[model samples]
Target: MIRTRFAPSPNGLLHLGHAYAAIVAHDLARQHGGEFLLRIEDIDAARSRTELAEAMIEDLRWLGLHWDGPVVWQSTRLGSYGAAADRLRAMGLLYPCRCTRADIAAAATDHGPDGLIYPGTCRGRDVDPAGAAWRLDMARAVEIAGPLVWEDELAGPQHATPEIFGDIVLLRKEAPASYHLAATLDDAADGITLVTRGADLFAASHVHRLLQALLDLPVPRWHHHGLIVEGDGRKLAKRRGSPSLADMRRDGADGRALADALRHALLPAGLSLTTGIGWTT
Candidate 1:
C-alpha cells in the first residue's frame, strides 16, 4: 500500500503554501486508495510550540484533510535517531565538527547548490563528540553506498549526488537530529512509500537519499510539487508574515472552496503557483 505523509513543523502557523502541500499529499493518497499520515516535526524543542501544533491540526481538519491514525511526533524519537547516528559513527563515516557557520563561511572556497560547502575544517579533528555537532563524511559515505539512483514521480529518475551539500550535519548541538536524519528515519519508520512536498526541497532530497543508503533504510519515491508564491514573487513563509490559514478561517474563508481552487490552479488574488524544481515565480 502506498503511504504518504505531510510533516509540518510546529514553529509557526500553517499558511496557504502548507495547505496546498498537505492537500496534494492527501489527495494523492486518497485518489490511489493509500494511507495519508500526519507527522509533527517538533524536534526543535526551543522553537516548537504545542499550541502551534494544535492549531495546525485544527487547520488541517478545517481544510478537510484527514490523516490516518494518530499523529507521530518527532520529539519522542530521540533514541532512535541517536542509535542511527551511533551506527554511522561506528562505521567511521561520521565525525565530530566544532566549526560554526562563521567558521565555515570564512574558510569556504567554493559554494555548492546548498550554500557554502564546508571546507572539511574538522574532518580529521579529534574533537570531543559530546560538545560538537556530528557531520557525515559525504565522500566516504557515497563510496560505501556505491552508485545510487532514486525515482521521482514528476522528475523521473535521479542520480544521487549528496556531495552537493558537502558534509551534512546528522545531529546538531541544539537539536537531537537534523532535518535530514530525522525525516529520513521517520519516513522509513512510518512505512511511507511516497514522499511528497514542495519542490524547494528537491535538492535536499539528494541528501536524504544518501542518508537512506547509509542507514540501510527503505527507499521511497518522491514527488516535489511546486511552491505557492505571493504577488511579490516571494514564496509564502511564516517568518515573512504570510497570511495564515488560521487567520483565513477566522475571517470566514471557505476552506473547502479554497482547497478546490488551489487544486485547479485558481489561486486567490495576489497568489500564484510556480511549478518545477526551481521556483522563480
Candidate 2:
C-alpha cells in the first residue's frame, strides 16, 4: 500500500502554502486508496510549541484533510535518532565537530543548495563526541554507499550526489538529530512509500537519499510539488509574514471551498501554484 505523510514543524501557524502541500499529499493517498499520515516534527524542543501543534491539527481538520491513525510526534522518538547516530559513529562515518555556525561561515569557500557547504574543520580533530555536534563524513559515506540513485514520482530518476552538502551534521549540539537524519528515519519507520512536499525541499532530498543508504532504510519515491507563492513570487512563509490559515478562518473563509480551489489548482486571487517537477500548472 502507498503511504504518504505531511510532516509539519509546529513553530508557526499553517499558511496557504502549507495547506496546498497537505491537500496534495492527502488527495494523492486517497486517490490511490493508500494511507495518509500526519507527523509533528517537533524535534526542536526549544522552539516547538505544543499549542502550535494542536492548532495545526485543528487547521488540517478544518481544511477537510483526514489523516490515518494517531499523529506521530518526533519529540517522543529521540532515542531512535540517537541510536541511529550511534550506529553511524560506530561505523566511523560520523565525527565530532566543535565548529559553530560562525566558524563554518568564516571558513566556507563555496555555497551549495543548502546554504554554505560545511568545510571539514573538525573532521579528524581530537574532539569528544559527547556533548559535541556530530557530522557525517559525506565523502567516506558516499564511498561506503557506493553510487546511488533515487526515483521521484515527477522528476524521474535522480543520481544521488550528496557531496554537494559537504559534511552535514547528523546530531546537533543542542538537538538530538538534524532534519536530514530525523526525517529519513521517521519516513522509514512510518512506512511512507511516497514523500511529498514543496519544490524548495527538492535539493534536501539528495542528502536524505544518502542518509537512507547509509542507515539501510527503505527508499521511497518523492513528489516535490510546486510552491504557492504571492504575486511577488516569494513563497508563502511564516517568517515572511504570510497570511495564515488561522487568520483566514477567523475571517470566516470557507475551509471546504479553499480545499476545493487548491485541489483544482484554482488558487485564491493574487496567489498562484507553480508546477511540479515534470508538469505545468
Candidate 3:
C-alpha cells in the first residue's frame, strides 16, 4: 500500500500554498486507494500554538480532505526522538556542540545548502553537555553509511550528499530532537512509504536519506512537488503575512468550490505553480 502523509507545523495559519500541498498529498493516497495520514509537527512547543493547530485541522476538513487515521503530534513523541539520538551517540556518530547561533555566525567561513556550513569548532572541545546540542559527525556518518542514494518520483534517481549541510544538529540544546531526526523517525513509525512535501525542502531529503541509512530507517520515495507562489514570485508563506484559509472563510468564500478549483488547477489571478526547485539548499 502507498502510505503518505501531510505533516504541517502548527506555528501559523494554513495559507494557499499549504492548501495546494495538502491537496497533493491527500489526493496521492486517495487516488491510489492508500492511506493519507496527518501529522501535527508541534515539537517546538514555544512556537506551536494549540489554537492554530485546531484551526488548521478545521481548515483541512473544510477543504474537503480526510485522513485514514488519528493524527500524530510531534510533541507527544519526544522520548522516541531521544532514544534515536542515544543510538547515534552510542555509535559515536553524534557529538555534543555548545555552539549558539551567534557563535556559528562568527566562526563559519563557508556556506552550504541550508545556509552557513558549521565549522567543526566543537568536535575536539570538551564541551559541557548540559546546554549543548547534539550534532551528527557528518564525515564519520557518511563513512559508516557509505555511498548512498534516494529517488524522487519527479526528479528521478540521485546521490545523497548530506555533507553539503555539514554537521547538523540531531538534538537541540532546548529541544529533544531536531527536524531531521524527528521527521525521519516519525515517517518510519507512521509507515509512510511516500513523503510529499514542497520543492523548497527538496535539499532536505538528502540529509533525511542519510539519517535513514545511519539509523536503519525505511527509505520512502519522495515527491517534491511544485510550489504555489504569488505575483511577486515569493512563495505564499505564513511568515510573509499571506491570507490564510481561515481568512478566506471569514471573507465568505465557499470551501468546497475553492478546493474544487485548486484540484482543477484554476488558481486565482496572479498566483501560479512551478516545479522549479526554488533553491539548492
Instruction: Please report, as a residue range, the 10-residue window in candidate 1 with the lowest summed lDDT.
Output: 272-281
The sequence of per-residue lDDT tens digits that candidate 3 reaches over residues 181-258 is 999999999999999998888999999999999889999999898888888888998998988999998888988899
lDDT of 2 by residue, 1-281 (tens): 99999999999999999999999899999999999999999999888999999999989988999999999999989999989988998889999898888999999999998799998999888997678888999999999999889988888899998899899988998778999999999999999999999998888899999889888999999999999888998899899898899888889988999899888889878988888666564
CA lDDT of each prediction against the hidden true structure: 0.91, 0.91, 0.90
Candidate 1 lDDT tens digits, 179-227: 9999999999999999999988898888989889888899999989998
Please give the ranking of all candidate structures by TM-score, highest first, separated by commas. 1, 2, 3
Can you give the lDDT of residue 24 in candidate 1? 92
**What are the candidates' C-alpha RMSDs?**
1.7, 1.2, 2.2
TM-score of 2: 0.97
lDDT of 1: 0.91
Of the two candidates 2 and 3, the one with more favorable lDDT, higher being better, is 2
Please count the clashing residue pairs in each candidate, in the order shown: 0, 0, 0
TM-score of each: 0.97, 0.97, 0.96
Residue 108 error, candidate 1, Å = 0.4
In model 1, residue pairs whose N, Cα or C atoms come closer than 3 Å (at least 3 residues apart or on different chains), thus clashing, are none
